[model samples]
Target: MGRTNLYIHYDAVTNHVMTRAINFEIQDFPKHYFPQNIILAESTLDFGRFDPQTNFKLIRGASEIQVYFESAHKEKMRISNWIDFETLEDMHGLTAQEIAEILYLFHANKALKSAFFYKLQNNYVYLTLPNGLNKVYYRHVQHFYPRFQRAMVVHMSELLNESRSLFFMRKAKVQALPLEIAEQVAPIFVNGLKVNFQQAYVKGSRHFVPLDIVEDELTLLTLDQAPKNHIGFIIYDSNAEKWSLELTLDRD
Candidate 1:
């Protein structure tokens, strides 16, 4: 026989309560993924947008359930259940803001201490565990969801890593530019400066090195010393928001 799939039932009408099910093998699932089934059913009280409307009605009446996959590895799937709310209080008693808050808390509770929890920051709730472990919870506020919506979890890690790498490269390039220029310009002044030299040459000028000059000097040096992966530059003048080439340097 094939392995039996696990399931859980959420009763949205009953304080958004969840029904327990038999535990099964989910050990191989990735840390960032949450596997569960979501169902929407008919509720007479008109609980508003938080309650699944059209989709809920279709699934509740359908005999066959459809599972949709979503995740980094495309392994996540959703399961659905039928919901029934008999009283208006079950639907109308909670406002949209309240319903959203409840949902936020529910997801956060499940994601505590994981990368998924950190992604919740996009949803506008800062999740933190007091002990510095992987546990997380919502802040105490009147309406939390109004401030932040749910965050996209899968690409957040990639985006953050790329951002940090780009920032580091930019800073390193900026720092290297000035140093490269100074090295190139050093030879030009070395023989001529046989006379007295003072710290004022650096401290009193009040003129700092420009990045353009550094970049130009470095590019020329690289062409002369090392031809591998070398790049040349073309200088331009600004007109009415367009640049006219002042000079172009290409390898001979």
Candidate 2:
């Protein structure tokens, strides 16, 4: 025989309970499997007692639940469940404080301003400044293996002024390299390459050189690559201390 311990929290507003349990058993037994007997027993509870005055019927018992082992030596497991209710009004009231805190944080952070804009499109987010438009696209590329790509940028009017002269330049930057060689050697490229700007630029030419070409051009003037991409596009602005970047994709 094995020993087991369980802890449960009741949310009267949500009309549901969450439980966490720990158990010990011999090595031969499957480690964290919930026996059918326990589930069947729990199904018999009078869930309707948790709420009244509502017509909501508890058709199924704990249909959506997750259980996982937390520790092997201590034989700990965690379980979560979402009970269906007649109306979410009670649950909403219970979590209102937590929801308000999240909203407050979003307003305080500049990064979150673009959160609303990102939802306007399926996989693209657009940020508009006085001078130019920054567009972000969600893409996936394959080299040796599959990988996802996302981009964000601060477009400067000064750079656009010289767009025609730099439009045909070719250059490559190390985005990702073969896993084995990536550590030692970075990606390199030659000049005069033609590339498209993922972000839409209205005032300037539609096309711009690859970022690598821009870096090489700056290095020729400044005498070195700024060591990273961020430093290469610095511009002065009045509305905000720094330019805002928009998110191209929301993670799955």
Q: All candidates' lDDT scores?
A: 0.23, 0.23
Backbone clashes counted, model 2: 5
* Alpha-carbon RMSD, candidate 1: 25.0
Q: So what's the TM-score on candidate 2?
A: 0.17
User: lDDT by residue for model 1 over 89-191, one digit each (tens)?
Assistant: 2344545554454445444534222221221221112222222211212222111111111111111122223334554553211111122322332232211
Task: Give the CA lDDT, 0 to 100, for residue 194 in model 2.
Answer: 11
lDDT of 2 at 109: 22
Q: Which stretches of candidate 2 lie over 4 Å from their true place?
A: 1-94, 110-252
What does candidate 2's lDDT look like per residue over 1-74, in tens digits?
12111122222232222222212222212223222111111122333222233222222222222122123224
Off by over 4 Å in 1: 1-58, 61-89, 110-252
Rate residue 170 of model 1 by lDDT. 39
